[model samples]
Target: MTDIRHRYRKLVYLTWFLTLDLIMFGAFVRLTDSGLGCPDWPGCYGKLTPLGAGAHIEQAYQAMPYGPVSWGKAWIEMIHRYVGAALGMLIIAIVWMAWRHRHALGHSARLALFTLLAVCVQGAFGAWTVTHKLMPLIVTTHLLGGMSVLALMTWLAARENPGPPVLLSTRRWRPWLIGAFLLLTIQIGLGGWVSTNYAALACMDFPQCHGQWIPDMDLHGGFSLFRALGELPSGEMISQAALTAIHWVHRNMAFLVFLILGSVAWKLRADPVLRRPATGVLLLLLAQLVTGLTTIFFQWPLLIAVLHNGGAAGLVLCCVTLLVRLSRKSTVPQGIQYDKHRHPGSRLAPAPISGTD
Candidate 1:
């Protein structure tokens, strides 16, 4: 039994590490613009690695060497794919462990199985993302899917080795924190959509767009949410206004999200047990704000851009984990008590038999 417990703990840690790696690689894929480097699904130009199909790529490049299918892009795409495959393997391993020790690990087995299924769906979306030529909706979904996997893994990690549970006299704030977390996640998804669609700089100003606080936005064109990426309903190229609209909505939503999360942090800070995480959330939010501004002022420096995305992910994970901890029921026995009063005819209660007698 001890050995099983040890093994379970190791699996949980390993799963979390792999999930982190998956997120990093996903970031790299986005940052490098190698998302469509291969222009194919599951393989690079129909081969496992770019080098494996060098001759083919060379022929295509020879025809148009300056095109998007360059050697560097293909390598980046292939590397991302490899990392994703490795992560998939790790998820499978986690599922296997959970099934093997279902009883000991509580609901971990069920959760692991669900994670495994989610990753499979995410992988399919990833393939479609490339095959569809970096469709914005698909890409955004892919990003969210990866983050969801991370969230699940973090939740599992928290559950497996939760420290001493916190005892809160009031439960009202707990639901608010959960709501705040959900809102932040939705905001993050919108942000991902903006980034994936290359709409970050559509609104260059901090609190406004194109000299107007709310520049004339074409919601119909901008959010043509159902159209194929890069194309409008009429088969025309998507308008710049649409891209600007996407960026604008994301920018505006950030303010609201920040306000809500900031309030949550303030509320959480009142609890001693939650102070550290609350502070951490506050610090990360500040970092996110600064990096976001820097990206605008400095023309989106690669390092800052990556850091901003990573910070957002980190913030969500931290808040969610803290909320999980705060919600856990105390495990301490509540029936045990020491009584000082004694009954007149009994010894268990100390001097408390006057009324009874």
Candidate 2:
């Protein structure tokens, strides 16, 4: 049992680190605008890395020095791809480990398998995201998929560690907390879409859009969510209004999500087990808000932008972990046993009427 526990813990730590690496690679992909730099799935210009296709990359860069196929862009895209592959390999290993030690880890084998399947689908969407020229919908799904992978790995890690079961008093809030976490996940997805579409500065002001509370929003054209990769349904290029709409929705949703999560945090503060995570959520929320505002006010500093995304991901993980912990029934202490004498309820006939009795 001890050996199994140690192995599970090690796997959990490894998955956690790999998940973080995946997140960093994701950031790099977005920052360099290399979502389509490779223009191929599982390879860069038909090779595994940029170095493998040095001649092609050189020609492309020489053809257009400022184009998306530049050396830096290729490297960024290639690195992201490599990291993604590494994550995939790690997930495969996790699944294998779970299967090999199914009895020791109890229910984690199934969860590990699910994660493996999820990452496979995520990889598909990633390919589609690039192949389709970063279609807004596909891109958004791809971003959320990465986050889901992170959340799943985090959940797996927690299950392996299995912290002290939450008290019954706290368990009652678990469902609501889970709901809040899901809502935040969706909001984060929208934020990702906004960022991927380069719509972060669409509004350029808080509490208003272009000096007006609502500015003239072309919702019909702007939010034609079923449009093509880069072209609108009307066969026209996607307009700034569409970008503004995406940005506006994400920005406005941030405020509502903040209120909801803040309320949850406040409610959970009394429980010591929950207090630490509650405080963490609050701190990350504040940091996200600041980075978000600073991005707009400072013309979208790269570092702040990346940090905002990372903070959002971290917040989601923390919320999900807290929810999972709070959902379990608290365990009784070792010394506690069924004894009618201790309770003195009188109505209860506890335990067996022993032969000695």
Candidate 3:
């Protein structure tokens, strides 16, 4: 049982890291405008790899030089697909091992199975992203789906190694903790919308957009979800005002996120079991602020934009870890003896949770 547990832990850890990488790579594909490089599903130009599709790629390039379909971009998009495919296979193995060891693994097996389901759905979104011609709604949903996979993997990995249980007293913090998580999720969705619509640069100036605290905006058009990439449902091209609305909403929401997460971090810092993730949330919040402002000041440099995306993922991971830790039930037997000199302020065990970070 110990050996099986160790092996499963190693596998879960690997999958978690790979999922994180895939999220960042997915960002890279979107940021580089390579989402449509292949212009097909699963395979590049209807072939398994870009190598065999070279002629088609060349033809497309010749048709429109500096277009989305080029040798470099096809490779980037194909590599993203290949990595996603490999991650899916790894997830399958995880489900298999989890089911095989379900008796000892307990709830983690189910979590692993659910992770498999999520990856499959994410794969569907990936296909629709291309087939739908990169529609803003579909692409944003795909982005959220990728983050969902990362969060689930983080939770599953956290369960692999049990830690000193969180105290019952910490239950009072649940509302605030969960609220912080919800706020972050919504902010991420808005950020996705901004990216999908190329609205990051809609308001090139920070704190004030277009030299106004509240610029002219089309709230209804900006948030209409049933339109094409840059068109309204009426088949009219979207205006700059609509894009400005998207960016403005996302920016204003950032201030709220900062407030809620800052408060949550302060609350969690008082708990020894949750301090690590608290610090993580604080640091990531600051990083998001920095990268977000620099993205505007510097005109959205590739590295800064990608890092901003990554910081969001990191925040999701931290939030999940905190939730998992807080959900643990204390297993200390009644009347258990404690060595006060060696283990201070601990009623159950001396060590804190292992995966809080």
Candidate 4:
């Protein structure tokens, strides 16, 4: 039983790490404009590999040298798909091991099963992203689906290793944690919208858009979710104002996210058991701020953009870690009491076990 549990834990951690890589790579594919590199789903121009479709790729590249389809871009897109498929297999293994050792593992297999479902849905979205020609809605939804998978993997990893118990009173922070998570989710969605619409450089100025604190923006057109990519609901080409609105909203939302998540991290640092994850959140927040600004100043350099995407995923992991710690059933050792008065501002501190059990 010990061996089985150990194996299952290891597999989950592996999947968790791969999921993170997959998300960042997905960002790379999008940032590079290789999303349509192959112009097909699950294969390159009806061939299993780009090499197999050399003739088709060469023809497409020759026709439009600077277009989405090219030798390099095709390989990039296909490789992203390849990694995604590999991660799916890992998830299948996880689900199998989970049910196989359900009794010994002493936990429900529901999360594992749900994660499998999420990956499947994500795959479907990936196909639609290409077939639909990178429609902003489908593309953004695909991005969110990938993030969802990462979040689920983080939850599974947390379950495998319930860390040291935080004070039972930590439950009071659950609402704040939940709020931060939701805010981060919304911000990620907005960021996805900005990327899908190619609006990252729409404003072209920092701390102010178009050299003003506020710029002319078309909120309705920019946020009309049902329209096709770069087009308004009426089938008109999307305007610069609409694009500016997308970038502007995402930028403003970042400030709110920083404030809320930063506050939660500050509060969490006072708890010894939670300090590590809290520090992680704080550091990630700082890195995100830097990368986000650099992306703007550098005109969306590939590395900075990719790191910004990864930072969002890292924030997701840290937020989930905090949630898992705070939501668990804490078991205080016998004879120990939480001493709020002695610790003053600390969130949790254990009184010495009065006398050993």
Candidate 5:
């Protein structure tokens, strides 16, 4: 059982890292307009690998000579799928191994189970994203789904990483941090909505929408979630004003999210125990702001847009790590610990969430 736990922990680490890579690769696919590269799902052109997708690719080209179909897009989308499949297999192993150790590992086994379920759901969303022609809501939800899975994986990995958490005695840090994290998560979702709808260019000028503080906007149609990429639920072409609304929300909400996360990181830095990591988080927050603005300034360059997506993923992990530490209570607190607060039978485990550690 002990050996199984060790192996389980390694799988947790592997899944968490791979999920991060998959998130960034997903961004590459979205930014490069390769979401429909293969114009199919679960398999690229009815094959497990892109090389085997050749015949289908040729058919795609012939039907729409100047359309989204192409050799490069197929490979890129398939690579993302391949990576996702690898992560899914790792998740399966995690579930089996964790269940095998359930008597000893307790709730961590349950966490592994939930993670398996999440991956399955995420896979379904991935399919809908392609099949629905990248509907704004589906695509945005799909992006969040990936981030959510990554967060779960990170929490799971932290739980299995052999240690009791290093707690900091900061006042009301938990709720404050939680609130900030939630706000940031919402902001990320808004950003995803903007990206999926190609609304980033809706506002060509910074700190203003079309050189006006409040440009013409159709909030009603802009936020309708059930429609295709650029159409209202009524199938009417989404108005330019609607696109402007999407851009404006993401643009302005960024400032509010930054203020919350920045203040939290800055305040946490005052704690001698957390100064280093807090400082690092502050740096990340700043970098996120830069990448976000640069995307607008540079007309949404591929590299900057991809980095913006990666930045959001990193921020989620940082928030989770901070929350995990805050939730801990340790007799000899310093750095991460294992087993004491994480006993299989104990109520809370202080890592990977739900005391899953």
Candidate 6:
């Protein structure tokens, strides 16, 4: 059982790193405008490989010279899909291993299985992202789904920690930590919306938008949530006011999230188990803030913009790890309170001596 635990634990870590890499690559695909490169899903232009789609790629370019289709873009899109498919296979293996050792490993297996489900759902979102023509809502949801998968995998990995879980309630600030994590997640979603809607440069200036603090914005159109990539549901081009609304809201929310995370980091620094993750949280936040500023002031450079997405994903991973490390609950099944007694190494005192004599 111990050997099984160890092997599965290692697999979880590998899957985690791969998941993170996949996320960064997906961001690269999006930032580079390669999202529609293939103009198809799973396969590239009705073939298993992009090279096989040469004629179709050429036709696309010929039809719309500078549109989303290109040989390079097709390759990038296909590569992202391939990596994602590989990750999915890894997750399936995780489920199989978890099921094989379900009894011995307890909830660890359950966590792995749950991750499998999330990956499946995420794959669906990926398909939708392409078929729906990069609809802003779908694209943003796809980004959120990826971040959620990262969080799940991180938490599952923490479940296999060598030591006993260090529940958050032990400290007086557990609620604050949880709140900060949730706030950060919401902020990340807002950031995703801003990105998918192409609203990052809507304001072109920091502190003030369009040379005025709080330029007029259309929150209604900005947050419709059911619209396509660059237009309202009415098929009208999205107004500048709406894009400003998306960017403006995202920018202001960052301050609130920053304050929440900053306070949480300060609290975590005092605990040794928490200090490392705390430092991670702080550094990611700082880097994300810097990258965000550069994206705005410098007119959204590709490298910095993509790195901003990566930083956001990293922040999510750190939060999930911190929460799982601190919380007693595991994604593993155990009827809420883990019955450590059933597992080996459990030191539950023997049932009181029976007096049947």
Q: Which numbered prediction scores highest in lDDT against the true structure?
A: 4
Better of 3 and 6 by TM-score: 3
Model 1 C-alpha lDDT per residue in residues 108-171, reported as the tens digit of each score: 8888988888889999999998887787788888988988888888888878766554434424
Worst 10 residues of 1 by lDDT: 345-354
Q: Can you tell me which runs of candidate 4 are displaced by over 4 Å?
A: 331-357
> What digit string (tens of lDDT, one per residue) describes model 4 on residues 1-357?
879988998999999999999999999999999999999898998999999999999999999999999999999999999999999999999999888888987663879999999999999999999999999999999999999999899999988876557755556777998998999999999999999999999987889999988899999999999988779999999999999999999999999999999998888886666889899999999999999999888899999999999999999999998888887776455345565666654235567846543
Cα TM-score of candidate 4: 0.93
Residue-level lDDT of model 5, residues 1-357, one tens digit each, is 778677777778878999999999999999998999987787887888778988888888899877778888888988898888899999999888878778877788888889899999999999998888887888898999999999899888766643333444564577988999999889989999999888888988878778899898999888988888778889888889999999998888988888888899888775544566567668888898899888888898999899989988988888777676666555233343334433664233534323442
Where is the poorest 10-residue window by lDDT in model 4? 330-339
- How many residue pairs of model 1 clash at the backbone? 6
Q: Per-residue error at 191 for model 3, in Å?
A: 0.3
User: How does each model score on lDDT?
Assistant: 0.78, 0.78, 0.90, 0.90, 0.82, 0.84
* Candidates 3 and 5 compared by TM-score, better number: 3
lDDT score, candidate 3: 0.90
Decide which is better by TM-score, 2 or 4. Answer: 4
Q: How far is 10's C-alpha from truth in model 1 (Å)?
A: 2.2
Candidate 2 collision pairs? none
- Among all windows of ten consecutive residues in candidate 3, which has the lowest summed lDDT? 331-340
Residue 167 shift from truth in candidate 2, angstroms: 2.8
Q: How does each model score on TM-score?
A: 0.88, 0.89, 0.93, 0.93, 0.88, 0.89
